[model samples]
Target: MLSRRSVAVATMFLGIIYLAFISLGIPDSLLGSAWPVIRPDMGASFGFAGILSMVVAGGTIVSSLVSGSLVQRLGTGKITLISCCLTAGALLGFSMAPSIFWLVLLAIPLGLGGGAIDAALNHYVAENYKAHHMNWLHCFWGVGATLGPIIMSFYMVKHNSWRDGYTAVSMIQFTLAIVLLVTLPLWKRIAVSREHERLDSMIPQDQVGPELKQPAISSKANVLQIKGVKQTLIAFLFYCGVESTVGLWGTSYLVGARNMTAETAAGWISLYYGGITMGRLITGFITLKINNRVLIRCGQIIAIAGGGMLLLPLPQLFLVGLILIGLGLAPIYPGLLHETPTRFGRDNSAKLMGYQMAVAYTGTTFLPPLFGLLAAQTTIHAFPFIVIAFIILMMMSAEKVNHILNNQTKSTGINC
Candidate 1:
């Protein structure tokens, strides 16, 4: 059993992790929410916003691909601290950006910083905490994502300046960076205590349960060679595609196709993210009763229905559909991530996490821009079709992963 001190330390560390996740999400929606005004101010085309988003996503892909090595060397705490600083500096740069060129350049560090913190915190939580904590951790991300548009809209409405919004968020990021610096040692303390607990829980091989008898997968083995790995990665890619496309273009779609004001569109988009926040908050409790697989399937179905709703002409349905998509997506990412150790192996989870993140960002990098091109050619009304297609692809890939994992478990006599 953990001593009271150890439990306190662990709780405190988790609280910090939650805050870090909030910081991680704070800047995500800023570009999207501000793009309507930003494009005109800079005399840029509507599709050009995708270029900036693509740059950010590209940088994220690079960082995520290398995050495993970085975490191994610098550890999660230092990585998170450094990432926070990088992101803060980038956001500050964003505030001063005079043109789309500068915004694209600033997006690079923004993406790099975000990917590192995301992978690091996700792996840490999945390794150390319960399924509920994973949900709640991501719930905090939703909080930040939800707050992001609200913050931007506030500044845009009150100050008529998106730069001021970026500046305000940058200040928040810098503050979190300082907090992370002070709490750096707590990570080690919690890690050591958890290690001690794990060691103490070890038992003789003869007494080990059947579930524990499976040999560890070698970390050196190519993770892509694993039976379900490719499918899981594909699922991740499409899942992120669906989410990022919406985030990057949802406001634009509202303004262009739906005839909504930029300020009103920003509010509606915030509601979409708010749905994610509220859904994840509720999902944390639901996880106590439902397994990850069930939650994931349910989320997908709801997302599909939400996408279908978007096809309707009624504005009321559009509002409901947006919220439904957010609620549907709330559980899927966290569920898949938390299940990594089980579907693969604990030894492989760390490396696989990085790969998964890289692929996810790859989707983020390319899909929205591709859609932007398509929208430029046709109309923003194409948005719902893209969202629906991505969700279907994600669902198929996820189910294939499940099938592959189940087969492997049956053949190898290892419980996943």
Candidate 2:
């Protein structure tokens, strides 16, 4: 527990984390909204999205895999501040890019910056904050996510310029970086406090032999050795695919398959993210009385129902489906993350989280384009059905993970 003075410092840093999370969202949603306009201006084909996305994903995967080492070396404070500044710089590059080449070139920093901050903050929050803050932290991200499209829409509607949206977001990110720099000391204090706790909790030398003192495996390697890790990884991977596919294709499916207008579809698409944000806002209250496992199970059922809605011939259900899907998706990611530290010991959780993010982003990186190919070969109507398939797979993976962890909890008398 924090002393009164450390508590005050933690409070300040928590506020800073919220801002950094917001900063994370600002650039993330900007691309999807602006791409419709950007694609045409850059003279790129429809398939160009895969290229750019692949590049970004590649960068994200690289940074996410190495995030553990980076955090150990640079500390979360320096990593967060530096990554935000890099992302801000990349955003500025995006605003000024005259061609698709420049955009592709800039994707490197954008992805790296985004990945590093994401892995670090997620571990930081899970290790330090309460379950409710995990939900709320993501809620703030949803707010930024929701705002990004709205900002782009305003510029698109008014000046027909997407550049202004990027510029505005860049300024916000830059401001956050400076704020983080000012609050650097808080990160140091909390980090030092965490290290002391870790050391003090270790076994005394008298209790264990030297041969048994050190782990046979590396910390990073031990992540995979955890009993339920495979199932957990699969759950996370499918979850990312399901969530990303729904968000990315919802607009195209509405416009092409349902014959909705682009403007209307864009507006409707925002409902998905809005539902996610709203759901987290509500989940914060509910989790006070419920366990993360129960909440996750409930979310999966709701998501399946939402996916079922999309399979109908009726077009109006699309919006409702998207909203429900968002709500269902809202709790899963954060809840799983919140469970990590306790499920696998705190020391191992950091590397596990980094690997989780890497795999999750890998799903995000590849699935949509594969879905795109599916849509191309079949029909746009396949979108909802494909989403349904992913949901089912995710549910199955989740069940396996539940079984594995529950058995461990029972046999070992440990609460996962």
What lDDT tens digits, residue by residue, belong to model 1 across residues 1-416?
Answer: 79998898899889989999987887987887899999999899998876887788888888988887788789889999999999999999989998888888888999999988898888888877778899999899877876898999999999999999999999999999999999999887787787788789877655765433434455655888877789999999999889888877999988998899999997887788778888888999999988888899999999999989988889999878999999999999999999887677877777788889999888877788799999999999999999999999999999998776666555665544
Give the distance in Å from residue 381's predicted Cα in candidate 2 to where it truly belongs. Answer: 2.9
Which candidate's TM-score is highest? 2
Candidate that would win on lDDT: 1
Residue by residue across 1-416, what tens digits does model 2's lDDT show? Answer: 44788778777788889888988887777887788899898998887877887888888888888887788788889999889998999999999999999999999999999999999999899887778889999999888877888988998888878998888888988989888888887787887776675577667645754222322222455678887778888888889998888778889998988888999997877788788899998998888888777888899899989989887778777579889998998888999898887677777777788888999998898788799999999899898888988888888887887776556544643322
lDDT values for all models: 0.87, 0.83
Local distance difference test, candidate 2: 0.83
